[model samples]
Target: MNDWPPVRVLEAAPRWLRKVKAIILREIGSRYTGDALGYLWAYLVPLAWVLAVYVIFLLLGRRIPIDTDIGSFICSGVVPYVCSRYAVNAILRSRTAYRHILSFPTVSPNLVGGAVFALEMVNSLLIFGFLLLLNYSVFGFFEMHDPVLALWGYFLAVTSGGAFGYLMASLSTIVPALSRATPIFLRPLFYISGVFYTANELPPTLRDLFVWNPLFHGIEILRNGLFIGYESLFAMAWVPITFILVCVATGYIVQRRRLSGAPVEGDASWAI
Candidate 1:
């Protein structure tokens, strides 16, 4: 009979979790290293950004028209969008950034990009928490429609982002051009994805256009789940789930091919 009490395997679980935690801590530390203002600056920069946007929206006479509060409204969407951007960027460069360490058998290619994303998610949450605190303390906004849905939305976004990140990281090997063009492609998405406004306010034509945008759907559903207690303007879980499946399958296929020693070079970059 096989022995069930394997001390090494049990010990390895804690060790691996610790290693992952260490990676997160190291990434956070590196962000603040040599900066005079340090980590406070990290928290402050996003705060300033939100304040600027909030003031601008106020001047614009409530662009999205949130009757409850604007700061909390913006805070909900902005933080997640920022996290999405960071995750995409981090995953795209994970290959080159961790190329050295990836040569080792014990280290995983996904770990570098995934860890960066994980850490960034934590950072994003901290920023969101600050915004929540500010809204409650200063703006007198204390509304949480559906805590369960809100939590679910966060999990779904993180999962979708992580899966997409892994896929992009693997594809970068074959499509280096994507690495260059992805940022440019995603720029318009920030404003158009309904981050600063409600999708219900959009014109019929514009709403139709946004309905096709996957990120738009994700953000909208996420916001609805949290703000309206899962009463989304476009409540579709399939979109993000589909994107996750497609990306993961494609990334895994690409990883397998590359690991099998294919000549994966040249114009294959465009196909990705």
Candidate 2:
């Protein structure tokens, strides 16, 4: 009569969850260093991009693409895309940089990746709030039509980024050069993903083609959610959702094939 809990159950081994929590805490402390510089960096990256794009468009004389504040409109699109790309790059690096810890039994790719995602999300949320306040303070564009949809879109962008990062990391474990090219490959998303323009405003022919971009759907979703009277005619929520699922599955398959001799990384598969 052994009164032991099953090993597969997470409740049986708290250490799995503990390791992920510890990694997340350790990341926040080490990265931030208890200083304003780290905080400034987090906010500035997205802000700077927004300002640059806004100014360029300002000179063009039609800064307000749709019926929203120029600043808020730009922030709505740029912030999510910027954060998503950052997460993708950061998570990709985490796997290689933290290879030592990942080798430990308690630590797995998914756990480390999850910890990194948690860290990036913390920063992303702070960035979003800071920009939100800035828009309200400067441009008075605080009106939100569908807050729920907006939030869901923002989460989708970041999660899709994490999914891509996971896939890249898993691929990097095999083909290192491919991971290095991720940024260059993703650069076009900024121009085409509706960061500076919405797909809804395009002509029917162009809109149909533009709507095919999953990133565009995330941007349109966030934009529609943030602004008032801006009903987006394009964007299918299921596009990005499906894209994320595919990426995650592909990443898992890649990881599994490469590390077939042992359990897939992220002990306590429930750790994710």
Candidate 3:
């Protein structure tokens, strides 16, 4: 007699990666199922946003401030804002939404949250790519002067978004009432962030006031990297970077405590 089949086990790193990929696929599946528009719907949202903002600015008699096209200018700012906002919402909801899966020891909320982080980052890129094509078509020019800075800025936006997500998720674990409150906190950010105008263009009094928002810094850094003519004078690189680190550290501690303090059978503890 001989062995009819062979079994192989993956090492830890590969196994972890495999699990992450499966979780990401599961997330995508659940999100798109039964939606007739499917993936096309994802691209439409950002497009509509950019179009609406651009039109609103145009109607308000806003002139193009620099040599860059208005569409590209808005894209640089809006893309990061949209990506950051989307990431925060997705990460915040994953806890209550995936509580059943977290009961398994091998699958922690950290692992699931990491998967959501990666998924949203990919979605950020796809959505950005679609907007780039649209900008090119409408404006006939698309140039990124500093790809490295561009990428770094985009990374900061998404990471900061994830960082805030963790904070909100941790809060939801305690208050429960705030579990669905991401939108209420986030809605005001849309106007304050530099999606429609640059920091320098704002009145001196207003510029100092709005610069407090880290997303404003994120957008300014992105525009500085993308447009040669724009200088993000108000963007202090340290602010958003520090914001990301602190939020993640604090949120990680809370999440770890929650995970370790509860037994596997007590699914109620897993509730956000």
Once model 2 is optimally superposed onto the true structure by TM-score, how far is the C-alpha of residue 11 displaced, in angstroms?
Answer: 2.1
Task: Give each model's whole-structure lDDT.
Answer: 0.68, 0.80, 0.80
Query: For model 2, how does the per-residue alpha-carbon lDDT over 1-272 read when each residue is reduced to its tens digit?
Result: 24555645646458776787888877766666657897687788899999998888878876567876788888888998999998898889887678777656567788788889988977897898899899898877676788898888788887878888998988877788988899987898888788888876677886777676777888888877887768787768898899889988998887766644555554443212
* Deviation (Å) of 216 in candidate 3: 0.8
lDDT of 1 at 117: 74
Candidate RMSDs in Å, in order, are: 4.9, 3.6, 5.2
Give stretches of model 1 more than 4 Å off: 1-12, 34-36, 228-230, 259-272
lDDT, candidate 1, 1-272, per-residue tens: 23456876786678767767766776666666736578777678667767878888879876554555677778766766666776776677666766666665555665566677777677666776777887899978766776666655655565566677778777767776767777786688778777787677789898878776556666766676556533556646677778778887888788757644653564232222
After TM-score superposition, the amount by which residue 36's alpha carbon in candidate 1 deviates from its true location, in angstroms, is: 8.9
List, residue by residue over 1-272, the lDDT tens digit for candidate 3.
13323223334567779889988888788876636586777778888888888898889998867579888887887888888988898888888778888776678777888899999999898888678787788678896888788778778877888889888888677677776777888898888887788888899988888877888888888877888988878887787899998888888777656545754675545433
**How many clashes does the backbone of model 2 have?**
1
**Pairs with backbone N, CA or C atoms under 3 Å apart (clashes), candidate 3:** none
Cα-based lDDT at residue 12, candidate 2: 42
